[model samples]
Target: MITIKDLNKNFGKKEVLKNINLKIEKQDHIALIGYNGSGKTTLIKLILDLLTTKKGKIEINNLNIKDNKFNLKNICYISNENDLPENMRVVTYVDYILKLTLGRENKLTELSELFNFDIYSSTLIRDLSTGMRQKLKICTSLCFEQDLYIFDEITSGLDPVSKTKLINYINTELITKTVIYCSHILEEIVEVCSKAIILNQKQISDVITINDKDKFINQYNQSFDIGDLNHE
Candidate 1:
């Protein structure tokens, strides 16, 4: 489980996150959404220790994230683009990541087959197309088994088909794993995440569960002055 309380962040004059509180139990899939610069990514970075926390308490499975006792063995972060190594060959990079995380090759092979992705094993990352890179990124990230998976704008530049493939994997393969999905596009995550967290005014404005998709989307659209999701 993850617990956060009284979280706040400021950049000189403007506050980013204010009095933020959230609890994520085991296997909870949450969608973190907000308008641009609403601190959604900051919150994820704080939880992942990519950014320092000055006035908040974050505990992952009751282990303080700010303390030395925190172990990231079960936590995995798949960022939009920063997580990938640009200079390495696709196969080499995957092997290196698997070696570091103690993951298996068979898993990557399976994901490759599932996505019909053939460039990872032979092409250098620089040579692959943008869509292929995103596909490779997902294949590499998801191949490693982790209790907590953090996806930060991971599908921003993918084609519709690739986006659906990633969404499908999150829904099917990660049935019981804790997932924190951060994306500006709500529809892509609504299918897999059980809960939706709306960030606004430098705090968590609303936290909703996905009991009814239509009702939830209507409410979500209203929050952002978005008339309808389908019209986007």
Candidate 2:
């Protein structure tokens, strides 16, 4: 559903990514893994057209993103909680997101409940706890119906219980949706994604089909020379 070719990104003279090529097929759940400052977020922003594409090509649903012809209404991106509407009430922000995505507002109730965010419906975003705000972001983003979902560090600040809820939801409800999941939590990646895309040294270093969770985790830990990659 998404294709990138010969992609390169730079800020001033500092190059962030180079020659990044990827293809995400329909209904494919992909884990985008990288160390801090490995340009995972930059790559995602490039895909979302949040950043200008000067070096290469990115296409969504076969339409070139550079052409400004691709409709992102079908894409849902959940990222930084700080980016949420801090001034808006939870319910109001949910309504706005539903409207923006052309999704049913009724779905908000179920999603909010699932994330245990219903009680905060009248609470100002800025007043909520970090975990609550993260749940709010997840609830708002997933309440909509979209073909492609991109989550960047989505589980950050989420409690263990809430994180499990999200994992179960994705494993069950999003089985057929295309997703680009970015996280440092290796176990979560192993559970939610069918394939892993490893970004290292400003480029895609490996793309591995995940067959065994334990085996993949072992390999991943060894590759990065780290004992534990399950934490953000």
Candidate 3:
């Protein structure tokens, strides 16, 4: 479980996030949705300790994130950023990540097969297409068991078919893990997450359950223009 209280982050004179508080319980799959400057990424960075928390507290599983003993071994974070090494082969890179995280290849082959990445296992990271790289990233990260999973724009460069496969894989395999999914894709959000947190004006404006699709869509359109969100 994760608990954030009175979190406020500012960069110089600009206020990025204000008075943000949230609690994520185990087995909760959440969608963190917002406009471009709505501070979604800032909040996530704060949670991940990438940004210094000047005004609030963040605790994961009862341990303060600011504590010196805090660790992220039980948390798996995946972003769209090009952080993977370009020179490593697909399987080698996955093996390296496994060695660091799980210390063993738990479901490594299964995940590769799920994303249809086995065909390119011997290919170098630089040679794979954008979608293949994304798949490789997901396969490597999700292969291990984790208490919390944070995905940021994971389906950004994926094709329709690949996106569907990733979403299905998450819904099927990661249903019990605490997940925070950040994306601009509306339909996929509704499909993958049970709860949607709407950020607007540097704060959490709403937290709605995904049960009512039309109601959630209308609420989202009201807070942030529907045109800015991807519905397909």
Candidate 4:
């Protein structure tokens, strides 16, 4: 569980997060959505301790982000800006990540097969296509079985088949985990997330649960006027 209270951040004269308060329980799959520069990423960074908070209290399962950096091994963050070493093979990179987190080499073959990723075990990451590389990154993150999974626009470059496969995998395999994903893709969020948060005006504008998702989506679309809602 994660509890944030009065969370605030500032960059020189501009404020990013403003007195944000949220409570995320275990097994909550939440999708954070907002327009670019609306502070969605900043809030995630604050929770991950990638950015320092000017004023707030962030607690992860009774452990503070500041004091429990090492204990956060239970959390996995797959961000767009973070990249694997170009020279590392896909398999080797996954293996290294597993070894570093779990202190053992395990499940490499199973996960690769599950994702239908068949790149040579020795192929360098730099040579893989963008979709393939994203698949590898997602595979590596899921291999460790972390309690908290944070994916920031993780499905950006994925094809339709890959996207469906990944979403199904998350629903089936990660039933008990807390997954917080930030994406501008509404359809994906509606399909996978049980709850949604809309960030606007430097604060959480709305938080809605999708009990009757179609109706929820209709209302959600009507609430914001940002051009036609692209439905697929």
Candidate 3 versus truth, CA RMSD in Å, comes to 1.9
Q: Between the candidate structures 3 and 4, which one is better when assessed by lDDT?
A: 3
lDDT preference between candidates 1 and 3, better one: 3
Note the residue pairs that clash in candidate 3: none
| Stretches of model 2 off by over 4 angstroms after superposition | 101-103, 228-232
- Candidate 2 lDDT over 123-192, as tens digits, reads 8989988888888878777877889999998988998999999999999899999989999888898889
| lDDT, residue 103, model 3 | 50
Q: Name the regions of candidate 3 deviating beyond 4 angstroms.
A: 101-106, 119-122
In order, candidate lDDTs are 0.81, 0.85, 0.84, 0.80
Tens-place lDDT digits, model 1, residues 1-232:
9999999888778888999999999999999988778898889989988787689899998899877888876787877774566778877887687786664778878888887787346677887777778788787778878899999888866888877878888888898899999876667667878898989889888888777778778777667644422223
Residue pairs in collision within model 4: none
Ranking by TM-score: 2, 3, 1, 4
Q: Model 3, residue 128: what's the lDDT?
A: 81
Q: Point out where model 4 deviates above 4 Å.
A: 68-70, 101-106, 226-232
Please provide, for model 3 over 116-167, each residue's C-alpha lDDT reduced to its tens digit, 9 standing for 90 to 100: 7773378888988878788888887887688899999999788888889889
